[model samples]
Target: MPAVQEVEVVVAHRERATLRVGDMFLKIDADPERADVEVQAMAIAPVPTPEVIWRKPHVLALAALPGRALGRLGEPSAASSTAWAAAGAAVRTLHDAPLPPWPGRSLEELAARLDGECEWLVTNGVLPVDLVTRNRHVAEAALRPWKPVFTHGDLQITHVFVDGDEVTGVLDWSEACRGDGLFDLATLTLGHEEHLGDVVAGYGADVDLDVIRAWWSLRSLLAIRWLVQHGFDPSSPGCEVDVLRARM
Candidate 1:
């Protein structure tokens, strides 16, 4: 026990905590033994390509930055143009970074799991396969010729930070993977069109927009399957249906 300190939890599904070391800052995650020491080692490793920057579990000694996330950056008006640009470029930088081998099951494996969920639900007559099949196909195809690269598995407005067209840092890498840059781009652009516009303009990167859209469409359907399986208020309407329907 290296003198236990205060544990501050962050928003998101996984358990993450920030510890106070007398006058120092240390981040800790749940581990059975020598967690602090291990995190310290990870922190010293070259920050895993920018995309996984958010996903790694490490204790860094860097100052936090200013500005809010893209979602909270306030509606896309005059005031947010710079923030918008920065968010997009930051994500681009992340996707451009070379990646190390990711440690989870491949995207295809995950998508197959989603299909299993869909099959189980439809078999039980919970939801129509027609409701999810179109999107599921999109998801499968996106993973089919997967080109592994640094990717922010979850690229949402809320996960990005900004400071006048410059990303001081990107947060939340727990879902990071070495996957298609197009996949990451599609994930961010799917729901938030405004953000997508800004990102395209800011990054000025060549991405197969169609491929991104396909994956985006598929992810939505997968989400619906998860919601239904987890008992998350079935009556609750979600954008998955709209995205899936439009594609079909």
Candidate 2:
């Protein structure tokens, strides 16, 4: 008799779903284009990524990464500083690679989206007006023009995996595009501010700390609504709400 593989739903929402069955992941996206982007981005990214086993119209299968995730949003990372630094170095390599063919959200697009999301947040009473206003002001600092690079647009900590001091793999490439490098930096350190130095040390570049901070606020503010609709809790300790509160 063969051992039964347990099916685990890694994430699920209206748009997409990821399932883990033993050592393989099955990604089901509403849009096949997103899966196409994921495949292409993984192929071109300099960093390690999950191996693509196969793909259908809306479903893609991939081999699971070997190591645990870097960390979760609402939890402290037990991963070593060396592991964090290794993730940063791998990110730097990805950023230095040739720009992907697709473009990321432009400054105007992001600013407009920020405005709309903020309005919705206030009108729906999802967050305090004062809190929304304060973070909106901070978010302005991240709206400035910048040279584009190959960026993993959603570089969440959970998406990066590490084994000891080495970054074993990075996941989720549908959002990859040419965008600000610091946005990736900010996203990686979003809920885990204490490890910023370790990441910067490995990035080995002079970055504007203020800009990264601005991005932290901006990304959090922009994410809250989507997170809520997607059944995620942003107000948990060490999560998005805390990241915004830390700025205040």
Candidate 3:
């Protein structure tokens, strides 16, 4: 008889839940379209991604990748500089690939979202008014026009896996779409500012440092409310709140 595997709840909130049983991860999203995007994105992405085992309605099953996550948002990554570079190279490949059919958020839409989020942050007293104002000003730099590229829109550190300085797989493709390449770069190096140079080296391209800093503030501001509602702590050390605080 085979041994029964334990089911670990990887993540859960109102809209989605992920369960891990043995080597299989089952992601259940309330929106089936998100799962659809994930499967299709993995199929078309140039970089390595998790294997799709099966799908049913809003639930998607994936086979485990071979390595540990590059790092967590609030923690220092133990991955070597080479590994971080490899992740960067992989991102560059993804950005250079054919654009996804879907269009990403427009500048107007992003600006509106930023404005709304900033209001919420201050009105609710979630953050100091000065901090919110400073980041809002900084976020303005990233609202300019940008050419679209295939982007892993939510390239959080936990999504990239590494083994022995090699990128084994990238995960969480539900947010993939045609968007700004620099946005992806900024997202990868968000909390880990020290690794930006290494990532750019692997990316093998010169990019605007100011724009990346703008994105750091922008993304952090846009994320705090959602994180709090979702039972996450954006204020934790080295996380989104700290990212905004640094901008102050």
User: If ranked by lDDT, best first, what sequence of candidates would result?
Assistant: 2, 3, 1
- How far residue 172's Cα lies from its native spot in candidate 1, in Å, is 0.7
The alpha-carbon deviation from the true structure for residue 116 of candidate 1, after best TM-score superposition, in angstroms, is 1.1
> 1-248 in candidate 1: lDDT tens per residue?
67666644333223445543343334445542334333332343233212212324444332343554555212333326666766667666666665645443476687677777667757877556776676666666676666676666667665565555555555545466566777666665555555567667777777666677777766765666565554443333324555566576
Model 3: weakest 10-residue lDDT segment is 100-109
Instruction: Name the weakest run of 10 consecutive residues (lDDT summed) in model 2.
Output: 239-248
In model 3, the Cα lDDT at residue 208 comes to 90
Find the candidate with the highest lDDT and give its number. 2
Question: How high is the CA lDDT of each candidate model?
Answer: 0.56, 0.93, 0.93
Q: CA lDDT of 5 in candidate 1?
A: 65
Better of 1 and 3 by TM-score: 3
- Per-residue C-alpha lDDT of model 2 across residues 2-68, encoded as one tens digit per residue: 9898899999999999999999999999999998889999999988999999998899999999989
Residue-by-residue lDDT tens digits, candidate 3, 153-220:
99988899999899999999999999989999999998999899989999988889899999999999
Total backbone collisions, model 2: 0
